[model samples]
Target: MPLQPLLALTNSEPEEVECPAPAPAPSRPLTAEEYFSEQPPEGDIGRPRHLATKVQKFKATLWLCEDYPLQLQEQIMPILDLMASMSSPHFAKLKDFIQMQLPAGFPVKIEIPLFHVLNARITFGNIFGTETPVPHVQSIEEGDRISAVIDDACFAIPPGYKDATALDDRHCGLDDEEGLLQYAIQQSLMESGTQDDQVDVWEALRGARPVTPSPRSASPNLLNSEERQLQRAIEASLASLSVGPQQAAPAPPPIEDDLQAALALSAQEHSRLESELMEEQRALDEAIRLSLLDK
Candidate 1:
């Protein structure tokens, strides 16, 4: 019986046991909620308004990593998201965006978000300190500068927003919503200056001077917001002339020579004046003495 069982085993070939390959996973479609909810690892959601402020400036830092630093990349996500989301609502009409012939292909999708809080109907006088209503857009005559404030909300966009669409041609194209907003703001700012008694806001901010309205003038507010921006840019350029990248550092102060020269001049003047004063005093005393003697 044992020999018969061994013979049967020897004649039979091992059964082929085939394991089926695992099926591929189906990709889930990305929903709008998911796109917006994907917060940058640093949690940039609640503080966009603060981030929008250009006050806390930082010098650019260079890195040579093959991959972007996790920290730096994470920092820009919220800004990008904010810009993308905000522009979506107002400029969604591609009619203009298309005619603009955005550099990137048509139907370009910007993954970023716009700042919701920053969007508002910005009227000139409505925003500035005095609420001096700016004349209607039509009322603005050509070449006349107008004075207006960026509605509090317009100023609410975060500075890091520039980082979001930097790489996207579609987003970077002038037709994109961000570009349109920038163009509009720059235009508005420019139009305010030289539009007749327009206040130079760039100067006020830079010089830390209080803003005062310029007197009305016959000059048309010809300069668009873009032109105004250029003016500011020029001013900024001029302001930096003393410390430009190309300029050489000034030689050390001529401290010793200046001090010695000042001292020498002071001494010479002091001696000359002292002698003259003494002579006058002596003459006065002699006259007083003679008067007393005569009396």
Candidate 2:
């Protein structure tokens, strides 16, 4: 569906990046072809990337939570849906965010909370596309830095939401958001079913849970009853993996001149890759440009 960017009016969150609604209006999320294709749609303005959050220290753990002004969850949900439809090299930020867990020495955690959007507006022509270098998707390093900023913001609970009394008296406002973030994290950990004493909140946080690999035959059987069937299955699988043509290897005991020839071949290979890389970069740029277009 077309996504509308909400504007924050009051001094609620520290810093928020809100996109201006495009002309003709986007009624749905950008298609993968559009998101990755060349040229922005007719009206897309740009994707805004800004860091905004609030922090609080409750007992031993430090809560690192975003103060989102949009009740629609514009920060993460749309990106997630886009990720579910695309592959590698696209929507990589969402992928990396899912894998990020709080590290030791910081006593940090992540939670989602909300605020209100007082009003909204639309900006004229795409400000970014007209520029020499229109903005592109963030790199892994840039994404990591933003993640770190969200994690490190907690020096202390903001002015009021410190003691239990503050929490008890909380209402549906900014302070409530802060408490909600902390409470959400606590609830998640409690639901994990770890014994209360076992989970020292200050200890290093957990990483994504590991997935079990499917079982494979540990040892091949030569004379078992199913040996014939196993051999046929293996042969069929191998046949399906036949690759395209490849250069034959040189003789094992290669001569000095042969090595020199191989070096020349390697140099030629590098030159070919360099050309391919330039084309790829050009295509990537076009894709980013078009992604700014309205869906």
Candidate 3:
């Protein structure tokens, strides 16, 4: 009986279990340094120059993401962080920024990195929740016509910045930064056109004609290093535009002789019509006279 007890056997089979690949260590968000170090992502040939640009680019991607694609949600984090970081410097330089005395059309040349408008909204939503007032816009035409206002709590916040401190409302003698920002945007949009002369720039770029390299133009040496740098940047951009891939060279301005010929032909046609009308009037008069005589 003791020898037979050892013959008992179990039918258990080995099974392989795959556990979610350990979630890949919850990869960390790219820090600001790592992000800026790379050449900005494609389609952002020129670096982002405004706070509204993220809202512009991500508005379609953001707003409400309850069921949005995982890809878009993944894309928003770095952008959001970068926006939060960039926002601080703008606030830090508020005194100096205001002093720049930027033209009403400042948006045309300058960019507004005012604050992370979406981040502010998200933060507000999390805190104030449904109490957060969404604008009651009853009308909208363009899908891009989204508008978000930064609440009073968000003004000049030094988010993602430590060395930078926020300017106090009473201390700075200003609580109307929102008004100031809106005024600036409105004035600039009105004075400089919707994109602040961006359309003009595209028009300039797509001139429908070839551009020849111009000789270096003279500039004031009196300009400070910063001004000189800015001037060089403008010149470089213009130079690039000048050398942009050539298309048909504006169909060679109609030859002066040809323009004159066209004008002459038009004038001749006008004269002939006038003469024909006069002749018809005379013929009608003659017919009326003959009819009366016959009567």
lDDT against true structure, model 3? 0.36
**In candidate 2, residue 5 scores what lDDT?**
19
Give a tens-digit lDDT track for model 2, residues 61-97: 2343343222223445576567656544323533333
lDDT of 1 by residue, 77-141 (tens): 45445655556533432222223322322221221112322322211122223334443312232
Sorted by TM-score (best first), the order is 1, 3, 2
Give the better candidate number (2 or 3) by TM-score: 3
lDDT of 3 by residue, 1-295 (tens): 0111111122223444433332243244555775688565333232232322111221111132332212222543455456555565433333233233332321111223333342212211221123355443222224534333445655554676532122223222223545434333433344344523332343466764323321111112322432333334434434554664763222222333432233334334445767999999999999999999999
Q: Which of candidates 1 and 2 is the stronger one according to TM-score? A: 1
The predicted structure with the larger TM-score, 1 or 3, is 1
What is the lDDT of every predicted structure here? Answer: 0.37, 0.38, 0.36
Best by lDDT: 2
- In model 3, what is the error at residue 293, expressed in angstroms? 1.1
lDDT for 78 (candidate 1):
51
Global lDDT for candidate 2? 0.38
**Candidate 3 global TM-score:** 0.15
